[model samples]
Target: MLQIEDVLRDRGSRYAVSGGAVQGRAGADAFVAELKRVKKFAKATHNTWACVFSDLGPVKADDGEAGAGAVILKMLEREGLYDHIVVVTRWYGGVHLGGDRFAHVVTAVRAYFAALHSAQSR
Candidate 1:
């Protein structure tokens, strides 16, 4: 699995993104579990994720942050990424970020793509 940790920070909140190849819903679930195995991720306030399989279409989970999963899913779809799972983790800072939270999610996912591209280019 590939991870882009600490993608962005704002208003005391921190964001990270992680992802890798997955087969289906079960694979996506396992990928999420694997991420949470990391101590910090396990303690995060929200762990939203989304994925698309050529065979299974799209799948997502908000993990308590409403619409977060859909936001990730839409980005993945726009990127034409398939058979992969991407997670956006946020550690809340005890303040409401409102719509800015969605923008953060997009930033995290974009960071993941950038990191992924960098890794593959190595």
Candidate 2:
């Protein structure tokens, strides 16, 4: 059986939008666009994103990222690991992430996600 929590766990995978002084709308748009681009370039069949804002709905998800993508981002937010962050999950068709590769992918996106979040926060 697959626990929802297990599926949601960040596992250190993240992508963020940060820096510069941009309004909520612009910031959100930028992050969303970037996520879409990444997904397209990765040739991923699925791409999902979630954004949390104090004054807004707090949580929003894009079905494109698939259920797992949305769930994983939510899990990370719940853990208080990030704010104003967006994460994208790519399911490689042939290649597989057994060890370091998996970690690398997650870390790379996490860093970018953090950066995006940081940028908007400013």
Each prediction's whole-model lDDT (CA):
0.93, 0.44
Candidate 2: tens digits of C-alpha lDDT, residues 30-67: 76555456444245433454555545534545445335
* Candidate 1 ranges beyond 4 A from true positions: none
Q: Which candidate comes out best when scored by lDDT?
A: 1
Q: What is candidate 1's lDDT per residue for 2-119, written digit by digit as tens?
A: 8878888998999989999999888898899988999999999999999989998988899999999999999999989999899999999988999999999999999898888898
List where candidate 2 sits over 4 angstroms from the true fold.
1-26, 35-42, 81-83, 92-122
Query: Any residue pairs clashing in model 1, and if so which?
Result: none
Instruction: Give the C-alpha miss distance for residue 113 in model 1, angstroms.
Output: 0.8
RMSD of 2: 9.6
Worst 10 residues of 2 by lDDT: 1-10
